[model samples]
Target chain A: MLLIDDLHASIGDSEILHGVSLEVPDGEIHAVMGPNGSGKSTLAHVLAGRDPYEVTGGRVIYDGVDLLAMAPEERAAAGVFLAFQQPVEIPGVPTMYFLRTALNAQRRARGEEELGPVEFLALVDTKRRLVDMERALLDRAVNDGFSGGERKRNEILQMLILEPRLAVLDETDSGLDIDALRVVADGVTTLRGPDRSALLITHHQRLLEHLVPDRVHVLAGGRIVRSGGPDLAVELEAHGYATLDSPAVEPRTASAGTASIGTISTGTISTGTISTGTISTGTISTGTISTGTAR
Target chain B: MTAMTRPATARRPPSGTGVGMGVQVPERAREPEWLNAARRQAVAWVDANGFPSTKHEDWRYTKLDSVLALPLAASSGRGAEDGPGSVSSSDLPTPQLGVPRIVVVNGGMVPELSTLGTSLPGGVRVESMAGAVRRPEGRFQQLWTRRLGGYPHALRALNDAEALDAVVIDLPARTVVEDPIEVVFVSMPTGDARWSHPRLIVVAGARASATLVETYLSVAGAPSVTNALTQVELGTEAELVHYVLQGERTDSFHFSSLEGHLAEGSRLSSRLLATGGRIGRHEVDVVLAGEGSQVDLDGLFLTGAGQHHDNPVLVEHAAPGCTSRQLYKGVVTSDGHGVFNGHLVVRPGADGTDAVQVNKNLLLSERAEVDTRPRLEINADDVACSHGAAVGRLDPEALFYLRSRGVPEREARAVLVSGFAHEILERFGSGPIRRHAEELAAAAGLIVLDEDHCSSGAVTAGTVHPGRGGRAQ
Candidate 1:
């Protein structure tokens, strides 16, 4: 459902993401793993259309629309959600009020009727339980004085309410405790369906344990060096990114419109392996997807 | 404490000090001996020393050149052809239900329009300053004479010389006023330039507690000026909550001086919201006189094109173990100017005094300007005093956060701006007054409160006293 083709982007004088490409088909979750300063957060910001990150070259295509050409708010209306790594604190704005405004704005943009206070409150009550968010927190100012876990859970709650077609999680697991991580993972997994997809960005493989992804890609030196099954996450967790013998110069996919995406299955498949959720690297090499094989 | 100036003998007759100088006094006939003597001393002071210029230290940031140049005359208490009577009453806020309301048109209190005759709680007296002057004895006599002893302010002296009437509220010892006393001053400018002096005196006796609200509003019309004065005296253990809402027409001018005295163990909290007038200025001078007295002064000013607002606050800690805090915020846009001058004084023998002053401004346009000054004069040791000032535009990060959530840029800006001003607005005791203030903020574009969120239906307007019909235009 999403295609990022040779997305070269920069912030000021520094070029962060240099010619990176990735693709996630319909109804699948992908994990992007990278070490410190490998531009994981930068990639997420660029996808969300944040400013100060100039996309010098390449394009982002989501559901056949030019995603990079859209503003941040327009992208949100078009079913592209970016869960910020650090949610901002908006004082004097009630949390529930902001959430309802956002939901109504998206709905109005999509030519749907807006929900009233009663209906909106009922929806929040149901989704808030999914993340175990305190009811009192919803009455306070948005993210004001909220603990780290509460902010993360609030983000997950927003994701569940918005129910976007494509979700980009940017290091959402960084500051969460094990319990919060499991709650956030479950929230994201519940949003999974035949028409939904998510890109989980993190440095640790622990989050993958709860919500296993269909693909794992290791990002280094501003480029995705290797692509494999979920076993790669376990292998990398055992032996860090230093052990991966990635090629020094990898071929870049020129354009998302012309690039051949032959191996990507557009149809829904079984989740038999995700329930077991554990397969060794030795048993997954036959099904491993590599950047060298995309062309 | 600064010594009060002794009343000087009348050098010139009241007639010589009248008319062309922007001040007009009534006939001295039938006036009390002491009041006549006081008005004579005030008129002589105004004649001897004209209005102060910007060169004066206190008037440095505020220029009186424009006001001093206007061709001004005393307002005719009766409505004129082009006065407030010409405008519809729908623009004014409806008075809250069951509240004791005193309605002042122009400068004089219209007894027919006022609603506080014999309905006051026990030990409380709400009367006109004119009536109070007739029975000047005991506390009323003492407080009124003490005010006349100080004639250093030129404009205040002018007010004393010309103001014909005022609202006098007396809360006797141990009296607890259940409902706030609402004083609405409506200015109706005549065809020619006119000015009015509105005065208020509130005395909360020992252990007495009450809330007072003073709202200044005007109908849109020719140029006019309103010079107002309020005196508050809190006795031992007394508590008072005072609010001044100044919302005049933008082309009119307004100036108010609030002087308060807090006794031992007494507390005073005052909030001032200034959002209208061509040049709106309010000077607050509060003295924490008795031991253990406390005071809090909070203010918010919103200035748009062709408008200027100034707040000069002076807090004096006179006795030991007293506390004072001042927080003033300003939002200036396009051709607007704002000024905040907070002066704190810790006098001798006033040890253990705690004071804090903060002034913050948000300039929304390149042409907008604000000047903030915090001055501290400490003569006592072992006192805690601090002051700070900040000036900036809206937080761009907060703006982006709101916009990123799909809120339009205009609505997002409104949210952030409202948030900035909410710090002061929320302090306005909740209900109709606060809701009216929010509506004023929204009208001035400082905020955009959601219709349902504001609960404005509770404060349905149009119940205001319709403007009096005088000569047709």
Candidate 2:
């Protein structure tokens, strides 16, 4: 459903996502695993089209259309969701109001009728149980004074309400206790369906245990050095990436209009060197998608 | 404790001095010797010193050049020369101050408008400040000289130096005033550019509770000046809630200083709402004189259409464990200017004091103006004191969200302004008055209610319009 092709991006003076390439077909789960700072969060933000994360090179395509050209809210309306590692605290803005407004924004963008408050409330009540988030969170200001678990759960709640075509979860397990982790995993599992795709970004393979991925890509430096079945996660967690030799992943279907993604060497984690999220390795251009439902 | 333990100096008025030069009497009052004596002395001082000018720290922003341009009216006007009547009854204070209310028209009390039953607890004193000075056994004698200087205003000094008539409210220990005490001062424009100073004194004794609502209102659209001063003392364990609503005629001007003292364990909450007048300024000075006391100073102002409203609040923490919170908000439109200068000072050794001060303003027009300054001078450590201030226009995103939901352009703008001001108005404990203040706030455009958003006719639902740049005024 989403195609990222050799995308190169930067924040301020430092470059993070450098020429990264990836794609998730319809109804599939893609897990991008790398050590800390391997451009996981950056990729999610870049997909969500956050501003000032300047794209020095490459494009992002989603649902058979160019995604990088869209604004953040536009991308949001086009069914692209980014679950933040740390949700922002917007005090005084009630959660229900924010969620409803965001939902309507997306609906209105798609030329669909926006749901009334009554309809929205009913929908939220049913989904609240799926995420195990209390109904009280809906009445409060968004993310204000919420516990770490509550923030993560609230993100999932928004995701469930929006029901985007493509979902990018950025370190959803970072602050969660084991209980919260299970709850988040279950929420993701419930939302998994034929028309949706999820890209779960994580450092640990523990989340993979709950929501197993069809593809496990080890983003040791920046590029996906190794791509294999879910067994690669179990292997890395056991012996660490030290013994996991860097092998060339699948080659491109065809050379794109832009420069090919650069080769990357696996830097030892002990070096304490690279800031880790540099994206020159496997960044992909999103322009490959041609039209709606074209995937 | 000695009287000199604090900064209040006791001068005793040079005993025999008479009403000094340039000071004229407001009107004649049949008075007792001591009352006339204090008036003569005060008048004498004011006459010798005219009123404070731009050079005075407090009078700087105020342009009293009009006072200087006066064919000044007599200091006092009698029965036939009333100002409140000149002000159309429709414009006079509505929602009558429901108590044994006192109406001080101009600087002297009007008996026809004054209603007080002899229902009083024995030993309790409630009289006019001028009458208090005249009466040897009244409540004003003891508290007047003791607390007047605590709120220093040249006009107040002038009132004290020559205060022939003032309002004095005294609640005896353990006394409860079931009904609030209301004081309404309506400036009567009897002559061109006349200036009148009305002074008020309210003292709540130990365990006493009372609500005082002072409306510095007006009677005429003509240019007139009302300069006044109020001193309140809340004794040990006493509670006082004071609300001052100052809305003068567009052509008139107003200047007043309110100084309050809270004794040990006492609580006082005061709210100031400035809605009208060509130029209106209210300065509140609150000093927590003893431990375990709390004072709340709240204010809301709406300035637009060539109006200038200024509310400068000063809160002094003189003892430990004292709490004071201040929130002031306003909106300025069409050449209107709103100024809020809040100073919170924690003197050395005043520990564990929890004080919060915040000021937020919305500028509805490019020409609209706001000057917000919250100054904190904390000399004590281990204190939880915070202050913040901001001034800007309504949030466009919030506006868009509201409009997209079918709230029209006008109503949406009003909701945002009112919501911002609501944060401050919510502090007023009185619901009815708060509602009235909310309505009064509509005039300033500082806050607009939801009902205010709906335009006339086409009752059901309508498309929300978007307003940009300036007030689609």
Instruction: Highest TM-score: give the candidate number.
Output: 1
Off by over 4 Å in 1: A247-295, B1-26, B79-92, B136-138, B149-152, B448-473
lDDT of 2 at A221: 43
Candidate 2: Cα lDDT at B259: 86
Docking class of 1: acceptable
The sequence of per-residue lDDT tens digits that candidate 2 reaches over residues B429-473 is 545566556556654444332222221211121122232232210
For the predicted complex of model 1, DockQ is 0.25
Q: Could you tell me how far off, in angstroms, the CA of residue B99 lies in candidate 2 after the best superposition?
A: 7.2
**Residue B109, candidate 2: C-alpha displacement in angstroms:** 8.4
Enumerate clash totals for all models, in the order shown: 0, 43
lDDT of 2 at B234: 90
TM-scores for candidates 1 onward, in order: 0.86, 0.66
lDDT per residue (tens digit) for residues B279-355 in model 1: 99999999999999999999999888899898989999999999999999987777788889899999999999999
lDDT for every model? 0.77, 0.68
